[model samples]
Target: MAKRSIYARELVNLMAGHWVARAVYAAARLGVADLLEAGPQHVEVLAKKANAHEGALYRLLRALASVGVFTETEPNTFSMTPKAELLCSDHPNSLRPLVLLWNELEYSAWDDIVHSIKTGECAFEYRTGSPFFDVLEKDMESARIFREAMAGASRLIPLAISEVYDFSGCNTIVDVGGSHGNLVSTILSTHPDLKGVIFDLPNVVESVKNKMGDEASRCEFAGGDFFESVPGGGDLYILSRIIHDWDDEHSIKILKNCRNAMGSDGKLLLVEIIIDTNNESSFGNWLDLHMLVMQGGSERTEAEYRRLLDAAGFELTRIIPTGQWQNIIEAVPASI
Candidate 1:
């Protein structure tokens, strides 16, 4: 009975998990970690700096400290923990943008999860009367934050991909829907001989100009919609986190357009979370729900990927697992 009661308590905690997530989000939004970057400070000091109520700020920090996000070295004085450091915007691996992005915008979408479940539609769109991308486009600050969040999250993905995939054989690589050319720059950095292109919407390409630093000489930028057409002249075409934003029909449309542009020997690579079918709890499963609720997209299983590839006249050649719930799915033109 005691064990069962403990399990029941665990269930209740799990059910109320949003409280913890929101707390973390709140800390990130408040820039509490940023304020503590210099050293330990009293909650009153932090509250003044942040323009927040002292008592409420004190409670928030105390609660967060209990969760290992911050440390209360002395009464009412809080300092950053390693986890909290990651919330500092200047930190190399800072997740501040992601945290802020989620808390500020995506947080509200979760409120409409019930609507999504009922209609199999986008909760974000349902709530705001505009699609997620449209909203991001209209809000410059949000778009910048969203881009920073994506870039911060992608810091390791390019290295993981470069290590796993052999880009030496390919002379040119094109990243479809590659925002700001971060991934492309990473690849170009590793392979000196490989030239690359960052292809996306016109505005996105324009904003990313010369942002690739030293790799700018080797990397080019192209602007267009993937649904209509993609640039050619690359031996390897990479679609990282592009396909999953769409349904099967739209995904197929994009893939087919890529196929039209790809040469006979060119290979297509999709970077995504290849969901597990064993029903074991995983981050990908939760992310799949995020997709459903937020964008009307989905994270797919390997079998589903195979079908999608086959439908687009491509053959699924391999799946390379990257550590962070992502996989590099390699495909080739079926006829080739």
Candidate 2:
């Protein structure tokens, strides 16, 4: 017997990462975090309420406990760790929806990861026989979770972005493809004078229309396809986390529509993960693979974004880093 080298240990950790993700998804799907939110509970209690086998649940928790997601309080009792608390549905920055959404997306797609890489086709579409958005449209429950997931990921950015970028010049902010209106709500709340128009698919819009909170009075909701038209006459049109969900052809169509909707003074703000050429460890670089597997999109570099924007009749202004999960790429309609 011999001690394994650090490289081998690191590789092992990397290989076992998916096991952790799937296990977390199981806990989320079972509403385990919500059940444990009050306090510690016996495995039997969790299993009964979760409708899962008691013995299997215990084994799952024990393995998750080893990873600090749960703490074994006693022989068979457990409580959520700080990390696990994030999976609670009511947590302000809850990752529960993301966990659920990712699980739904990856359940089949990840199994076809090889096909995605070799064929340059979305693994999800390969297995499901429909595009991701179409599937979301058909399944109302999954659509709701997807909206929550996007807003949960985006809600933190508005706070960080407002501190760095001035929105005072912009009289109206049109949130294109805004899922839950969380981003626009935050922006309106922060800058009270600015009006917001949240646009998404009709079903999506209807679901999130009431989610705008105190700012609802100043906001309007519209439902339509961005490829056809965006809500016109907006000073700042935001395509937050939208471009990364489609290939260049579709993305350009959406951008061109936005460009057509804007006047010369209008600015287009794209919030997304910008992949870096230098770092293999970059989060965006890894997510680029996820876009390929799940959405048939790829995260882009600044240069790539510039090219894409230019093709759709816009000029890249400056990219602002919000010290969070994404950066804001601001562009204006290009001169004729």
Candidate 3:
């Protein structure tokens, strides 16, 4: 019976995850969390403001309440929980963009996971008629949302990197494909002696410039294609969650670009999830499937990273584990 109960619990948990995602989507779409930012409100009042049915809204909130997303002080009144507060749009680490993107793009593509299993091709392009980046390029609104989502996801990475890695000896650090310069800002803020460069496409740099502010003076923004070239001469080139976005060929191109741009004494720091073959339950493995469905990339093992770095003319130096499940792979230019 214990075994049966465990199976039942797992089944319930899976269903609960779906329920939570749908609830989050509804809250995001209706701006419920944002509306409740001031205080709690009656269900009818919230329903009326959101143009939703009163009884349905109550039921929805009740479902979310059971999961601890919201709390019910009275029968039909709802208030935000610490968990639900993260959905608020104004929050610096808001999950709204993530919810929107996952539901809009990843969720639908995920429905065709069998397609990936059978053919080993991205379900996104198979379903959407274009690659993810290409689709984002054509749709400005989606592109902005995607960029914002990336920025939000990156909010913690810089701090994690700063805490885990030693940047004492480094002077100039280049953040390759650094979106919004958040990671660069975090690094520079931590290491007062380190001046940094945020390198990405022109549009990405433009979008982030205003946010950079005074740090903009210390940090240089270089707009160019990573495939074509990277700004040279930095002692450290940081690629945070960058390599997992491409296949080996393209990943090699970007790494080689960094390698070429590096000074003889330079190091390349790749901040990413390193998959362990021995681990059964790993987020990196799940993300590997996500990459297959969305971006056609794959999370790699440390050995794979070593091989890629070697091919790109870099010597794999050290792998430092961060506070999170991420690891920073430090590599240096191969001896001539």
User: TM-score for all predictions?
Assistant: 0.96, 0.93, 0.93
Pairs with backbone N, CA or C atoms under 3 Å apart (clashes), candidate 1: none
Could you tell me which residue pairs clash in candidate 2? Answer: none
Which regions of candidate 2 deviate over 4 angstroms?
A: 1-5
lDDT by residue (tens digit), candidate 3, 1-336 = 699999999999977787788887887888888878889999999999999999998888898888887889887999989988988999998888888888886689888789988998888988988888778767778878888888776678789898888887888999999887888898888778889999987877877777885667789989989999999979999998889988899899999999889888899999989999898888899889999888778899999999999999999999998877778999999997
Question: Backbone clashes in each candidate structure, one number apiece?
Answer: 0, 0, 0
Model 2, poorest ten-residue lDDT window? Answer: 1-10
CA deviation > 4 Å runs, candidate 1? none
lDDT of 1 by residue, 225-318 (tens): 8888999898899999988888798899999998999888889999999888999989888888888877889999999999999999999999
Clashes of 2: 0
- lDDT (0 to 1) per candidate: 0.88, 0.89, 0.87
Ranking by lDDT: 2, 1, 3
Candidate 2 similarity to native, TM-score? 0.93
Q: Is candidate 1 or candidate 3 better by TM-score?
A: 1
Better model by TM-score: candidate 1 vs candidate 2 = 1
Of 1 and 3, which scores higher on lDDT?
1
Model 3 residue 33 CA deviation in Å: 1.3
